[model samples]
Target chain A: MKNGRDPVIVGLADSALEGGRFVKQASVLGHCALVANEALKEAGLSMKDVDGLLTAGMWGVPGPGQLNTVTLGEYLGIMPMFVDGTNIGGSAFEAHVAHAAMALREGYCEVALIVYGSDQKSLRSRTLGGRPSVLNMQHETPYGMLTPVGGYAMAARRHMHEYGTKSEHLAEIAVAARKWAQLNPAATRQDDMSIDDVMDSMMISDPLHLLDCCLVTDGAGAIVMTTAERAKDLKTTPVSVKGYGESHSHWAISEMPDLAHLLPAAKAAKRAMEMAGVKHSDIDVTQIYDSFTITVLLSLEALGFCKPGEGGAFVSDGRIAPGGEFALNTSGGGLSALHPGMFGMFLLIEATRQLRGDCGARQVKGAETALVHGTGGTLSSGATVILQKGLQA
Target chain B: MSYDNPLPVIDQDSAPYWEAARQGRLDIPLCADCGKHHFYPRTVCPHCFSDKLSFDTVSGRGTVHSFTISRRPAGPGFADEVPYVVALIDLQEGPRMMSRIETDDVESVQIGSSVEVIFVRATDEVTFPYFKLT
Candidate 1:
């Protein structure tokens, strides 16, 4: 490690997942404790040894889910010195990692545990509707824009209009994700799918087919972070957190500054890569949040992998597929793996696993550097983190 | 057909915007300092920190920046209106707003097409400013 103060992820684990469903059915907090204990165990530490806690979920707001860290800490019986219960949407965990890095670097906490759990599929709590028609949502819900999906669809349509992108380009992303998922035993949708399959799939929103969306499943993930010196003595090889940045532009999709251009992602990625002192070419693998196919495309462009309006071409010709030049969403991504509700936590887990060479068939060969970006709240929030194998002196 | 759609929940800051819609007018908050317009009404100027803001009527004209056809209804309230067109309108006044684009053929709605706001009284308390192709 370069410095004793450098923050590195020492442990990562997800709850018992079978066909993308939580095998050990438990409450949100129960799953939280389950994944937390597993991840801590991987780090050769227990919850009692943790001094910091970070968590987020869509369990039950205005109720138990309120003050998530307090509820989780109480459930896990750990009173921490640092706590963050930021609920920015699916990408909250990525933001948490960014915050945890700062805390670990500053010695605010000795051991930081970030956890997320959701039972949206098991409970069938996932809704195809928009948010409540109140406050900022009032302007959107009344018009019946199928939240999340509709926002992404509108962006896809605009992207096509501006850059001559095709639905086929978007389909290639879904097809590619499925190919990766087929190799992942934990992936929920491992069935073979082609571009035509995505095109023929039912349309949830125009310009976005059912296959273009991510899977809805029940899952939970947790990660443990500490200073490089402490992580060096942990159970597993630590993946150093080289750089990270988080930002949000809007809550309502209508408020997005630019549909064609993901400004927040560009800003976050620029800062993270700049801090890591790496260029786009130096990134060996990328695990971007795929809330929608368009999200991956837009994120690739914003992350500097390709030029804006060039994402359509960047992802074409199966370049991002298994045998392709670029390795993206190797854990199958949210598109084909599992999207319980918030998927940012899983991105971190998979990115860490890849860097540790824990993945079997789906591993990117000699992957030393990985870029993980998460898009939450209908492209309203973007968080980018840069990770690398082996600590730098 | 009977009106069975979700209605906007008006709040204090957005009361005037809805009131203007009820009067068949498209009113939005205009920042006196930045001279910029914002939508879905807010207390502070989004572009500038100045609280010097006032309501002004826009041309009710915009171009469709982007749109999507919801093959599935957004919620139970919109169950009867599947395949609806929700669009982001780039208002002539330079601000963007989200509203449904009503047309006989939903597929005909294209980006860059001109649209004008048309107020639809959902109830005594709610008047939605939907758009129609011009």
Candidate 2:
């Protein structure tokens, strides 16, 4: 049974590896625990202080033999009064923050923990992008259609056909992210990347060069949240959760309603910015999830940073790079930094890091407010969160 | 290693559509209530969500809404078909479906290209509705 708990923001921590290097043969639960313990330590509290637990679950349908919330709770050795196994693919963790915030505000539980870890690259596991199965594969799978790149390519192709967005427009996003990566030591790729280098890379899918795709690195990220009052008494400065919102339009790429429009982020970002009482220009820094180059472009357009078809032009010629107006993806994002399958958790961790002034070299200067957006399920789901440096009255 | 291509599983609502594809015809769900057509043949009308639906044969003509040239195979099953073209086909009857665009050269297919559907039997389990430039 559980009792009273306060609403506050306290600790934030990621896994041991800040970048692409990962522990081979590592279990998922081990990754989850490692980060949760690190977060608990950072909060100046022990595991016993955590009365509530929420984790981004395995991205799939739950059946007889799947990882359920109760199973994960038991694995973590925490008997929480409240639990959520909401799996919205990459955007799951951002949604978890909103859920955790509600739980904390309503006094469901205090000291809640959200964690995500994936061992895709090291183990070469097929948790995703595996051979089709009866229950797992979509109808389009039999037609030589598999992998997320194909679906994302379809959207990019549509955006090109409709808006005349060139591959160079997409290339700029990859360039900016790689430039950010160069400043961060922990980032996976260390090459001096350029837009030409991006264009020179092999085409994985038409219009989307190899550079446009994200690395399948194995990693984990976690964050702890308590009430603002409780957070103030803690060790490190609490990164206040100003506002968050999440929404999804469809599950598959083929069913995205319109290829040119990214409605999930449009709707979710609107709700989040409304709740935060901040306009587009007020955002000091943004950690837009860069699962793919087009993902960032579509997100920017959908979130109203640019007009509908002007995302390409907006990122042109050193716009979103290191000293660009947006100060976007300061952690190099999933592109040049790390992408361990579910990337929503990493966005929160990065946003919190920027707000805390903990990000050393690649940190945005005097970064007060940061917006994190995560797109999931082949541009199907979108989640947004705004984190501020100091607590607001 | 006896490998097999991943085939589409026939479900309750989509069973009739796949069966029709096996017979070299493109049948889509048409809702009598809304008087509109929908793709990926389902039990309920996507427009009105009405159960009053039936599979009807169509002209199988559509224009390419968008497309991609997969320089790499999508998965293990598509390894042989590298550099394939997949397109989102806007049906003449007013619905869109995802299918492969069969072309000798990728340059021939683009947005708004007139395409017609043709059933290409992948395996005994299922036949796919492939589109080709008209």
Candidate 3:
């Protein structure tokens, strides 16, 4: 059995939403505080007990958002000794959890709180352009490639050229995500969808239809962590953070090590699983980030769930859909569920919920081990975390 | 004097490359140590991390590694150029770079298509090294 010093997630909460619509309007920071309070309440703790604060988002750039941890700490009245504002696109939260785990285990912080909130949907500020045409972005932005969709489209097209992966293979992923969304009440898009429907959606970028992309919604999620000994008195069942790892290869799509495969994800997943002493067969559920259908396909291959170039075949014939052998993105994922700008925080939240048996219709039966992975910044960054129920070895 | 498309911001590290482009030349950074070429001009060689680098004008020939057709305009600035082709070009000197494959018939462009660099003068100081099917 693991000792008491092992770091475990004691609380997890997200802002209540009905079909990705917040009941009440709030600023990005407002959403952050709302979710943080609820998560702390669930853990039977309060703002006074939070000694570490971590957050990341695409808000207030050119302003206070630059110092996100400091801005969030001031807003929440948290004088956290340990703060992390590391933002590597959407996968920032998964990396934050890895950082928090080390901070908790090393006695740098007693209680760690990681939060993420975004108002992109509410503010209607989401843009198709890439990051500001400055620095390294100057090379990509001048050419007018659609910010994210175009990059994924290039990858999807290349995957087809190399592995003979067809558009239908990618559409199956979107269709399956929508099928899972139909079971999730909070999912933004619950309507039934077919492969034909996905293929028919407007082509934002060639090879990537409208449905291939994730939804734009406003959301915030929080996770609270402490040592296993402190969890003995908490109200919620502590989910052990067995292992975690993160890596980024290149910011520019052209500089990616390989277009057909995700090298960083392969490295990150291998390290995390090895540290957890688990194998592919030991994983019961997963919450893979679905920024785009191709994202999921590439991620599955990188995670070693299937051989390279076999992700298309692996996800076909209702394999990852509802009642499929693999329960992937049980919260409907960023595809059908709420995307909220950054989707990694929700990946962590959903995996924790699945491990606690909190998911009702979409729950994996007797799920004990859940693997959550997040892909960020045009397939540039990858972070993986392996979680298990209680203190089981 | 009416070009409205976005232009690349030339910096200290990338100034020489842009200067060569203004002269209608495709100059890319070549590492003197490893004898390798790279794109988007960096101070150090990405392959061998060598500081001994010089800008060299090459044949400006490449193959289309991958591409995407932006059915919708990327932004308001690109509103007039709807349904354009953006592609990653595998340069003959061995380094991949992102560029637009300018063509009247978008359907004709495909992976492995042979392309050669063509310069488009956007402004007094900036010239985009666009690619066209050979």
Candidate 4:
């Protein structure tokens, strides 16, 4: 209610999710409704009490799932006063939290529900090479720049070129993520993983092994938000939306201002932490989007957790693994856990658990604050949200 | 994973760049207002928002800014071109662009290595710019 100045206006009450390794066919809308119901149930709230709908449209579609806001609202048959159909790719859900908080504070709605579900794996879908935009389809696509994996690989290669970052530095992240996935029952890659194992995997692009890329799986995640005042009346403890911000520098990777200076994520994190009155060192846990190892490395340095060109070194020696000084992607992340294309929502879900002292084996002990960062497109856009444990006055 | 290579969907903003490529030349937009260059040709300047832009042909020479020797085919269309090098080249004219380094020795492409542009005719009228080690 304080124009988002204070970090206590909105809190995530509950979330419901369904995902992973599906052999049967299902639509994006069905997953949306299922997660919405489960999320509301966790909050001990019903369809009648739901007043707002928030979601990033399904992934792999030509456009972000912008249509689902209406189809989902109609399918659920919930007449709501508020609906947000914003879509910015993987980080769209993170931006939704910012929108929901502003909406709840402005009295546009209470009990905002955000949902995401995708069947990319079940369908074995591969997004077409061409982007609808003239620049992508015509200006850029002809250069063999069709694959997102190739774009990210170029980034890693760039880092290596600039900072003397070795493939082993990136391999540490994959190995650490797999280590955490071993503890997460829901993670898809549960096999015992090692740096050698990652190194041995066939190269998808030069410098990135198959294991270095995020797993493709069908999954959904949903979370609920409400005014801080109403959170006191909810069944579960509230995780406050202390600070959040989103920004985009360019839609295509070729246009990024400078790879050395990571756009969007750097600016978004600066704004989020500035609003929260917290420093990078104050963060107890991090749930950064990991579409690839380079994404996480760039995000860490961009978010000011480490200095520029030091991300590859900062993540070395198992520093981000469980029981390390700095905790990152504690949910196994898109790397090993469920990644149905848009994996931003799950970052919040895991961050909330860490803040709530609920992550059993992977929990950061006494974690009171968690920073969630999401990267969309070929590192084109970014969103950062800081969450802290809520206590009544 | 299927047949034909993913081709460009040419439009107004892109026609000139494609046209110049077919002529075996590197013509990119240089903003007359900000006096800078940019890639993925745009209607106006990204820096100064200047509509006064011109497609100037420059010496097709640049240095490798960053590169990856992709051991796997980036697309099924490139299946025969496995272990190719894709690089972002910084032109002498102060703009960077992404293209493949067309060379037999993929291992020789390094950051700061000099490269010269070469045109590969993709179609009767369409050509794609590639980099050759200088």
Higher-lDDT candidate of 2 and 4: 2
What is candidate 3's local distance difference test score? 0.91
Candidate 3, A67-120: lDDT as tens digits: 989999999987999999988889999899999999988889989999999878
Per-residue lDDT tens digits of candidate 2, residues A98-117?
88988888888778888887
In candidate 3 the C-alpha lDDT for residue A98 amounts to: 94
Residue-wise C-alpha lDDT for candidate 2, range B72-107, written one tens digit per residue: 765665777778897888999998888889989998
Q: What is the iRMSD in Å for candidate 3? A: 1.0
lDDT of 4 by residue, A233-339 (tens): 77777788888999988666667777656779989998999978898778999999999988999999999988889998899999999878889998789999878
Give model 3's docking category: high
Candidate 1 C-alpha lDDT tens digits along B3-91:
67677788999999999999999999999999999987998998887889999999999999999999988877787777789999999
Model 1, CA-based lDDT:
0.90
Model 1, DockQ value?
A: 0.88
Clashing pairs in 2: A7-A227, A8-A226, A8-A227, A8-A228, A9-A226
In model 4, which regions exceed 4 Å deviation? Answer: A1-19, A23-25, A59-66, A127-134, B1-3
Give the distance in Å from residue A54's predicted Cα in candidate 1 to where it truly belongs: 0.5
Residue lDDT tens for model 1, A122-241: 888888775888999889988988878999999999889999999999999999999998888888888889999999999999989999999889988999998889987888988999
lDDT of 4 by residue, B3-120 (tens): 3555677778878988999998899899988889877788988878999998999888999887767676545777788778878888998888888899888888788999999998
Worst 10 residues of 1 chain B by lDDT: B1-10
Candidates' DockQ values? 0.88, 0.61, 0.84, 0.56
Top-down DockQ ranking: 1, 3, 2, 4
Question: For each candidate, what is the lDDT?
Answer: 0.90, 0.81, 0.91, 0.79
Angstrom error of the Cα, residue B37, model 2: value is 1.2
Estimate the TM-score of every prediction.
0.98, 0.95, 0.99, 0.93
